[model samples]
Target: MTASPEIQEIAIVTGASTGIGAATARELARQGFHVLAGVRRDVDAEAIRATGIEPLILDITNPEHIQALATRVQGDSQGRAVRALVNNAAIQANVPIEAFALDQWRAMFEVNLFGQVAVTQTLLPALIASRGRIINISSVGGKVAMAAYGPYAATKFAFEAVSDSLRRELSPHGVHVIVIEPGAVRTAMLGRAIATAGELVSAMTPEQRQRYGALVHAVNEQAISSTKSGVPAQAAATVIAKAIAARKPRTRYTVGREAALLTMVRFLPDRVLDRVLAAALRPHYPKLPSVYDA
Candidate 1:
């Protein structure tokens, strides 16, 4: 590897505030890398500093920030090349297909898919120079669709394809590209998803609300329980950091039990999978009055 920054390999981890992103940033720092922590909020700078990592104010959706990052990594007179880029920032907004909002869908993609791409492309030259790796943090949702998670799943699926193409294209240049697909972990996003679902269901017509009330409740309960019981974000981050540090990294790293199972489910017959999903996600609707009963 061609080294530029004297303080070990300089690693840039985006969304380094809390959860997996934060854990990964800390792990990288512990591994003796000069870590550049990227977060949208200035308040998070202290959190990164606490981990002994340098903080950069970066909102993936901001074009100016992307440009600045690219310029900085390209180096000035001294010439410093970033050795690794961990695209760990993402957002999950659940929007059931039937009632999906275009604005929310676009917002999710802006952060989860488009934002990652903007940063990656901006820093590609430096990555190529260092023969570094790019780790795109995806999710199991990307591989399989579930009810009420259409928007999030769609973006993740897109991320998977994007990562795959980058891996193929960059392999010859000694740049490794890998993806991390973590299962549900206890995070703020999970709670937000539940709240969003409740809001959506509440706004529906009384009849429609009645139709989906039970189903929505069931989903919310499941989500809350899973958040409580899910793999800790730190565990997932460990797997991700390993992926970045390994000399021969795998193309994909899946964390959590459900993440692994979903990969297998990908091979099941389409009809079988569809039926399974229906059972899991079909909303409960009360039976209409029959003419005989009336």
Candidate 2:
């Protein structure tokens, strides 16, 4: 959906501080749409400010921030129609289900799932009015949960479900709901997730630590390895920009080959898939004594 020459179209991208979100914001701007890049910090806002890109201080979980964004879109001084709303804000931490505190789970969900929902809901009116697209940035974790990835994957799984339901609900209204599932993209997120996992591991009980320590270590190592081999953030952003510009965009798109393959393999039998994942993770396991060795 290319923007009309006469009308100034707008594209909103949340989590524009770094990584895929930041890349997408710039890509969309380059495509001729006025981009509203959402960032949490003043430094990020300053960094992303550029031609065709306006940085907005948006914390999707904050009602005031979301409302302000809605107001800005709805009452555009230039009367620009919002062409797309990219729900790209999210957080992640790889920790065992038992080791992650209940509040930690809630906090993650609040940012990853509920935060996206809030922003989407607030902007739905403008989106429907303009017949705009809703691009949700999900992850490969949404399709398959590995060891120590329970909490992070759960939110993504729920997010995918929500995207499906929202797509069906909004189709008749001329709004497009597209989900972008990306594999390990070389980004700061992975490092932050690894650090969070280490902290969680430190907080675990002696028995829990003994049971899951190697698994957590292996997961972190696997993450690091995958990230080293992952595509750059710009590659994912290009895919997203293509989705935004396609006349008949797909319901879902994958950013990397890893994501494409994993999403397909997810349909395999549960036990078989379990072995596949375990096998994939086994190579990254540390050479230390642990429960998996028993």
Candidate 3:
């Protein structure tokens, strides 16, 4: 049973439990698209539904949840194709690369990179059928890897690659892949990241602390202060809506002015960029003792 074009205008948003995902879900709903809000908690699902959007219990990293979501979306679409998929779920680990454990790296990828890929792959068929678009929620970190943010930025770097490859591969098939790279937009994630940094510091061995304690404290405090002046989550959501509706959306979009400025860093040579980064982080980096020191 072929569904009508109007019936196929459905949008699925991952990580609708909070932040930009929640804002996107609300925005899409307002834009007249039938939105499937993917959330992990029952409470979140209920709250999202109250806004007249359909909320599905989803944990993108959980294979069972992913499979279940695929099935539910298929059945619920009633032969209609799914229009858009917003891969907006991500997690952050903010420790220095040297202090990072393999498990911590894996944990970050599990939710940030792998989960996004899993959700995109699982629902690709519906997207293909509808000639839809894939909106990936990335970060300014995708273009610039900061000192203590290396691991988290690495995930976004990989994501930029994935989106580029997917966009090239899907263009001929009438599917559009767009990456949204946002700078610090206000969200609960920041506070959680700050708290997580403290946990990471507490979990460090005495030797690890000696090497990274100062840098970690400096980075966490800076992150907290920066969030105070970030753009609202809805601002990013508005850009997502524009991307979805544009006749020819760009391959990549930097959501905020700061993000656009950050993306320009790619034009600089690695050596030049390295010097700039070193200067920015030097104040926070621990000073080593010289032979003349007491």
Candidate 4:
């Protein structure tokens, strides 16, 4: 059923306490949607409330919190049958695939993949009733592989697949599924990734460290600098809000410089693309033996 023009649009945005999630929630509110900002802690809830959006305490992994969110949305006239569900929560720790702990992988997938699925499942009926949209915030890594980001990107690739299947399955129900691939945004996630890389390096065997040291250091420096230079969180959020609000949003939206450029690289010849990526990341080796600085 087509919703009324005056149906009073409502939205639920996970990971809404900071960065992209917080910005998206505020932008949606500015667009006149009643937004439920899903946050994890009391401080974050308070912070979100300060923006004049209702903040709900939500830890995506916890079933009770999910239940509470479902119950609340199911009951509120102003907020029920939400018109949009923005899945923006994710956790990234840069452990290598070989050295990555099974439990850590499970935990990342729990919040990044399973938790999102559980939340979407709980709200699917309401979303279908309202002919709503589901927006999954993925990453450039979802489309391209990287050395140390396998665990995080694995979840995003899963999310992309989820969005595709959902778009096909829910079209008959008048529900739309959109995936947003953001290349880089200024957020704490990068800091966490860098810290995780450091931790992993410290715990590595000498041979392992020797093999990966220069490359890891280069990546760490790149991540730190990029965190400062990447597009602001608000820019990404604005794009997401646009995708959600438009009547005919694209199935996938790629945001930021890296996302746009790297996606184009996918169409290039394999040998050319390989050379480009390798050159971009390869560490500089001295042409001649270096003398030690006294």
Candidate 5:
């Protein structure tokens, strides 16, 4: 029931300037779809233009941009049907909830969850017409919350909820929704996180700094270690490509060794998993400020 190539099979990939998004754009282009890759900057657009993917200036968090992207795509889609929508745009902040600001929380969700919802809503008609697929790129952290990962995990956890509801609502209409959860993919984002760990702590107030010092160090160390050992962005992209082309895809496609392991971990009893997680993060525990400490 998928749209045929004669209809100009169009695929929109957001956040396609680099990492999994870029890889997915290239992979989809290779699969014969006219890939409209969304990038925030003209420089990024210029870089990918040579690869045959049309660069679109889209900032998912911006309503105007989202509307424009929809309008522009709808126009270019005159002879085509939107065959796939890859929602790969996302942002991550690493501070714990206690240290995280409200604006930070809102901003993260704006890009990671709300913005995607807007895109999906605007494109649902095209998706329904083409019997197209919607692919959401989540993270291994989406499966389970970890120490100092609250802000990012909150958005992703909510993403899963949104994806589940969306899948149910779209399935009857022949439009499919799939979630791809990747683990520790080596990307510019990871590189920046590792290189800029100090900045996170530096932003904290004196008391907050003292409270999160060792914990931040531990988390960043583990993050760097994980990124160094992480899967390539192309691996996740290949899985996404397959999912899009699938006649009957699974509801969720968990990619990478870490993601598979996290899936398995989901079955553990709450208490058992609680103990395991606590033990794992014990080495990173810093002295927390308390009444007694004061």
Candidate 6:
């Protein structure tokens, strides 16, 4: 049964506290959808509360929050059909695979990958009932994993795979599952990642530090440079909105030129790609004393 013309459709965006998530929530609301913006704190909830946008306290990792979100959607007072679910909550840290502890790796996956899965699973029933869209926010890292981005990239890669599988499975059910691959967007996420990397570097043993210290520094510098030149979160949100609104949306959409180019070249031979990535990092590495200089 189709929703009445007067009933506003609902769109849910996780991680609506900041960056792409927040921008998408505002954009969706402006487009006339009643957006359920998921934030983790009361402060964020209050900040995002506005006309057509209702903020809910949601930590995607918490089962209680997920269940509450499901209940809220199912029991909407207006009986609005859910239109879209944007899974955007994620965290990142730049630490080498060897230096990152196993528990830390698990923690990253719990939020970045598993949390997203849990949310999607909970909402699939409503999404399928309404023939809605599921938009997964991936990254350029989903296609190309640079040095010191192992754990984060792994989660994105896994998400990319899950998106593909879910898309195929749901296509027959009139549900669209889309993936958005965004390059470095000018967001606070990069600053937080750099700080986390700094903490991880300090915790490394002497041998581990010696092995990965320069590499971590280079990665951080490169990230800062890329973020400075990156597109605004609004640009990504625009793309996401387009995908959600399209009658026949593509399975994947890239947010920026950098994301498009990188995802395109991800098929290059491994050795060649390695050289290219290494060259990109070389300029950011700290200068080292040579024997001649000594």
Q: Return the TM-score for each candidate structure.
A: 0.88, 0.96, 0.91, 0.90, 0.91, 0.95
**How far off is residue 205 in model 1, in Å?**
4.1
lDDT of 5 by residue, 93-208 (tens): 56767877788789889998999999989889889988899999988878888777888898899999999999999889999899999987888887665444466666777788
Mind sharing the TM-score for model 2?
Answer: 0.96
Q: Please give, for residues 107-197, the per-residue lDDT of candidate 4 as tens digits.
A: 9999999999999999999999989999999998788766667898899889899989999999999999999999879987788777877
lDDT of 6: 0.91
Encode model 1's per-residue lDDT on 111-193: one tens digit a residue: 99999999999889888888889999999988997766778889999999999999999999999999999886877668777
Candidate 6 error regions (>4 Å) = 1-5, 288-294
Task: Give the CA lDDT, 0 to 100, for residue 262 in model 1.
Answer: 80
lDDT (tens digit, per residue) of candidate 6 on 188-290: 8898899898888888887887788888888988989988999999999999999998888999999878899999788999999999999999998878832
List residue ranges in candidate 2 displaced over 4 A: 289-294
Candidate 5 at residue 28, lDDT? 82
Global local distance difference test of model 2: 0.91
Sorted on TM-score, best first, the list reads: 2, 6, 5, 3, 4, 1
Worst 10 residues of 1 by lDDT: 285-294
Q: Write the per-residue lDDT of candidate 2 for residues 1-294, one digit (tens) a residue.
A: 556657779999999999999999999887788999999999999999999899999998899999999998888899998999999998899888998889999999999999999999988988999899999999999999888889989999999999999999999999989999999899889988988888888888888888888888899889999899999999999999999889999999998889999999999999999999999999988886754333
Clashing pairs in 3: none
- Per-structure clash totals for the candidates: 0, 1, 0, 0, 0, 0
C-alpha RMSD for every candidate: 4.7, 2.1, 4.3, 3.8, 3.7, 3.2
Off by over 4 Å in 5: 1-7, 195-197, 281-294
For candidate 6, the per-residue lDDT at 88 reads 98
Q: Per-model C-alpha lDDT, please?
A: 0.79, 0.91, 0.84, 0.82, 0.82, 0.91
